[model samples]
Target: MSTEPVLPRVRPEIAALPPYRQGRAASADGFKLSSNENPFEPLPGVVEAVRDEVALNRYPDATAGQLRAALAVRYGVTADDVLVGAGSVSLIAAFLQAAAGPGDEVVYAWRSFEAYPSLTLVAGATSVQVPNRPDGRHDLPAMAAAVTDRTRCIVLCTPNNPTGPIITRAEFEEFLAAVPADVLVILDEAYAEFVTDPEAVDGLGQRVFASHPNVVVLRTFSKAYGLAALRIGYAIGDARVLDAARATLIPLSVTAQAEHAALASLARDAEVRIRVAELVERRDRLVAGLRDAGWDVPDSQSNFVWLPTTDPAVATAFEDAGLMVRPFPDGVRISVGEATSIAPLIDVAKSTILR
Candidate 1:
């Protein structure tokens, strides 16, 4: 006991926080559908572009000006209004750190993004989690009511992760009107490209920040553009707001390779959309098949479908069939993977869960 060494003290919150984990890996022959990832391979042009950025000896441009400019032009925003980071998650952390601190509060919907609670805690802020509706959509009015004077930021995940229903344009507009002007509203549209609903909120089309000025729209190349490995994403908001987030970023976190690849991907927007269309079609078929198999699947507008079942046997059935899916406390999220995966997934449901 006397010879025991003392370790450095860490914050209790930090000590208690469970580290973020990725989706479970699948077996060699299994179709990996746990992660809501683009099933397609990276475009040939994107691969070549990434390869061209081979000057590893040099530090990448910390500001990522080129990529920022490209994004700004596409969104009709100034370069100052755009801020790029390692990924949407990293950019979200930066924005949270910029606006919140000890004793402050961050408001978001529960059963939403897995990272929201961890991000809030890491930012030294309290998370005011509003429960989702029984239908699995965020209760927008309840979220607005949950806001207090202590709330510094609020995050809205459209076509919400895991559960794929989106906040409609009318719903969003009403919610925006109810929230205070000073509180930061983070519109996280990670799966925006997959949305087919005409009524879903379009942060860019509405020019939300133009009038509100408090809203920040976040998007990524990870989901639709298949640039997840590079971890590049960006935000669109007021210049001053984006500046705050920029200040909190780790230096040169966005690599040259990521920038080039994203730029190349953007140049082939038409081709990317074509791939996205294929995935969307697959998702619709999967949903229809699951519904026909007696699953109470939600009307998913994202690249994944939610199976509303807490039965362990359902998850076991999927695993046994060599298909990996993400199981939460209430349901499972199965990404629309290879076209071949659909038949096996539906077969498992019919053979086990539906029985």
Candidate 2:
């Protein structure tokens, strides 16, 4: 008989993880507002550039030089400060591999981004999550207090996911002051474009390059850029930190077409701005609607709203209305799409909400 073990050996962390699940599309003609994709079509020039790039029959530039250059100009950073990845999500993985290991601790906000604890666990590290405040914002003071010498990094998601809230500049600066100088701080700004917070913190890259030395910012073209399918994202940080990120990344992860499309997007900034402005209006309107309906909705700064439904029946009611929103134990994250896309979700609230 073969001497192989009956069950396959696996890392306990990996084995323990529930697979990643995003809300599914409802039907052939049903709205796909589950994922936070931009409702607009790609800019004319961006589509043409992507088509032109596909004819090259070659791999993308390993360094993604042209895309990096465009991003640098947009962010007011030098080329050395930017590190492009397959997606902003990929950089999170690279950070885990480069910075954390067994017995090390990773910290982040609970219900901020569902991916945080999963990413930390996959890296053979322990996750230390501080709960979000009543308003769905990250609990900055508590998070800063939890950081210890064993802590490798803390991810600060602003205009935080799931719950659309931001970290105020004052709160963030205080959090930074409390954290050890050596501990890495990753500010994931995946939804930065939609944020209307006048007092928001700009995050790690711009300042760390000058002084703090252990901070990084992750941004993506997936949402406001209407490039979700392209899967391109970049990180900005101190040169040394960016170098470390690049070292651990797989070569040529970005496709040539994606690089071209991203570069094309830089030139279409004005149009994207108009579209983003529309989203902000819609988001604010949705928040007010939900709040008036007696659902405790926070002031949303991202492209979504959090319906804090501590009641188990709330999610089922949403589904009963033929709307597929992400239901968390703490709340439901309702993505904002075109007006028509969310009609079903609105219908549910109108019918079931006794008001």
Candidate 3:
């Protein structure tokens, strides 16, 4: 008999899926500009509120009722229309599970969110990745064309992660027109607070809900509210569709601490906007500096900028300059970090630019 150890059977797709890659952490003296995170500390009282309100001995509210009601009021929706989860990624996974199964197909833009592939695979659905345009925006027409009878869901990431370009409101309306009404469409807007472009699509308005019953909007406290550690996010959509997603939700995953922090953050919306405005200004300055230095940077409306280069040396150059940036196969994504980090980042760009 062979002496090889027996292994439990695992689904081939699950076995083959690579783990999600987090942005690289930097050394003590280095600036961590890899993760597109809000550089500011939490809003005043958020930490104190979480500390005071959390009941560690008891389970959290399974529905996150108060948070949902607050979000609904802000967005002019009913409480039933809001669904909370551990993160927007969890909401995506829940909606995918609700709408798709083995042999079904899910559609989204390529080079968008890194988690999309893993989420789809975990839901046992086939992925149809439509390529992004040269400017790093979604090719909505191609994505609409990719829909087939097996297609069950579609994801649209505005100011798409890692690349930082946005889908315009008009373009999104047209894209929605092209997509079948029955196919579920998710608008992932994790960086919505950082967006300064007036033309960028916003899925929070009531008009989108009134017109598109099949559409779902995902928002997170991670990026703007500086609540990444809490891992709380929510979705806005039709009650029936949200009901299906709720059915698929992992019970009580949204902790009481996260909910309290979100409420506290929401209470200080003005402060959040101020912080976001500062980041937007920093991003614009960084982009302008890179362009003036002869780098062909794309129009980034998010909290990060993308440098289109296939050369690994460029990323290494950033590392050498004490800045950690996220590098993809085709380019590198640098988050808008501290005011202090901007000069060094631009200096690196200037030095790395080819004549």
Candidate 4:
């Protein structure tokens, strides 16, 4: 008999799927600009609220009622219209599961959020990705045209990851009018709070939930609120649609600590806005410095800047200089981090351009 052991059956698609690649961690001496994390420390109130949820013996609220109520009030939606998940990523997965299955198709912009493709695949749905425009923004018209009868959903990411360009409000409204009212449209606004561009689409301010029952707006506490470790995010949409997503959620994945932290963060919105403004200024300075050094940096409205280059050598150059940056196949994304990291980042960009 052969010595090799037989393996159990597995879904071929799942087996072939590449694992999600996270930003590389930095060494003690290096600045971690790879992940788009807020550099500021957590607000004191948020920390205290998390600490207060120390009753480990009991399970957390499966529905996350208090947080949902708070978010509903802020958005002017009913509590039933809001759904909280472990993170925005989890909410994305839930939405996918609720709307898609085998033989269904999901459309989204290419070179957008890295997780979009994987989430679609996991739903046993086919992904129809429309390429980004030359400027790294979504070609809304092309995406709108790609939809077919089999298409179940569409994802739009603003201030797109790894390539920082936003979709304008007018463009979004026009695209929405073209898309089928029966299909779901998810606006992934993970970096919404950092946006300063006056014309950029504001999903929350638009009251899309009220106007378009088919649309869902996803927001997270990770980036702007400095709560990545807590893994909390929420969505606002039609109550029936959210109910479908809630049915697919992993029970109690939203922990008490995460919910408390989010509530506390919301309580100090003014303080959070101040911190976001500081980061915005820092991002502008960094972008200006890179442009002055002859690099083609995109206008970043998020807390990160995009360097359009496919060369791995460029990324290695930044890493070697004590700056950990995220490198995609077509570009690199460096987050606005500590004030000290700015000078070194600009230096690396200048050297890379010279090469």
* Cα deviation of 264, candidate 3, in Å: 0.5
lDDT of 2 by residue, 200-297 (tens): 87764335445667889888999999898989999988889888778888898998888899999989889989999998888887777776767778
Top-TM-score candidate index: 4
Each model's lDDT comes to: 0.91, 0.83, 0.92, 0.92
lDDT of 4 at 11: 93
Candidate 2 error regions (>4 Å): 1-8, 204-209, 342-344
Q: Which has the higher lDDT value, candidate number 2 or candidate number 3? A: 3
TM-score of 4: 0.98
Candidate 2: TM-score? Answer: 0.94
Cα shift from native, residue 3, model 4 (Å): 2.7
Encode model 3's per-residue lDDT on 1-355: one tens digit a residue.
Answer: 9899999999987998899888899889888989888888999899999999998999999999999999989988899999999999999999999999999999999899989989999999999999999989999999999999999999999989878889999999999999899999999999988888888888995348668999999999998899999999999989999999999999999999999999999999899989888999999999999999888888988899999999999999999888999999999999998999999998989888862
lDDT of 2 at 235: 91
For model 4, the stretches where C-alpha displacement exceeds 4 angstroms are none
Instruction: Provide the TM-score for each candidate, comma-separated.
Output: 0.98, 0.94, 0.97, 0.98
Residue 310 local lDDT, model 3: 93
**lDDT at 276, model 1:** 94
Candidate 3 segments exceeding 4 Å error:
1-5
Name the regions of candidate 1 deviating beyond 4 angstroms. Answer: 2-4
Lowest-lDDT window of 10 residues in candidate 3? 202-211
Please provide the root mean square deviation of candidate 3 (C-alpha atoms, Å): 1.2
